[model samples]
Target: MDRMFRVLGFFTLAIGLMAFAGDLTEMALLFFLQTAFFVILGYMKFTERIYILLFWAYMFVTFTGFSYWTIFQMGLPL
Candidate 1:
């Protein structure tokens, strides 16, 4: 379990750096990867129900925010 978390963390950090590099493709990919990583991590820890719920909530918000940001960048309406 610890190993899994470590791997997820590593990927999350790597994706985060790539996202920060200002490439839209990389940023989108990173957001997806990080979101998946968090979901998996949350599921693996069965004892932490609250954490899982929170992580899923965060994922939902992140996805929505990204979608909105993309639409706005494309000059679309809300």
Candidate 2:
């Protein structure tokens, strides 16, 4: 499970690097922060259920933020 977090961190780092190359600095920074977060979580000791819950909470927040940005900030057509 911890290994999974590290893997996710690396994947996020890769995405961040790609974003940076594409000139999406803000998105790259976001992914870089998330990569650091996942790496930190990977080193922490916690119950499996807690990790799962934390991940779900993370997903919810990320999705919600993305939705809010796309709808409100970006002003996409409905």
Candidate 3:
């Protein structure tokens, strides 16, 4: 589980690097923050169930925010 968090942190860091290369500083910064968060979580010792719950909560929040932004914040073509 801890390994998984570290892997996720690395993945997000990669994404942040890519975004930075693309000159999307805001997106890069967001991913950088996420990378930091996952890395810190990776170092912390927690129960298996707690890790699962935490991952699920993170997914829920991310998906909900993405859905809301796509639906209401973004300007899409009809």
Local accuracy of candidate 1 as per-residue lDDT tens digits, 16-73: 7667676667666766677566657645655556655655796798899889978877
Highest-scoring model, TM-score: 3
Query: Residues 1-78, candidate 2, lDDT per residue (tens digit)?
Result: 887889999999999999999999999999999999999999998889988998999999999999998889999785
Q: Kindly report which residue stretches of model 1 are placed more than 4 angstroms away from their true locations once superposed.
A: 1-6, 17-46, 76-78
What is candidate 3's lDDT per residue for 12-59, written digit by digit as tens? 999999999999999999999999999999999898898999999999
What's the CA error at residue 42 for candidate 3, in Å?
A: 0.3
Q: CA lDDT of 28 in candidate 2?
A: 100
Native-vs-model 2 lDDT?
Answer: 0.94
RMSD of 2: 1.1
Whole-model lDDT per candidate = 0.66, 0.94, 0.96
RMSD of each: 6.2, 1.1, 0.9
Instruction: At residue 20, give the lDDT of candidate 2.
Output: 100
| CA shift of 28, model 2, Å | 0.8
TM-score of 1: 0.47
Candidate 2 pairs with clashing backbones: none
State every prediction's TM-score relative to the real structure: 0.47, 0.93, 0.95
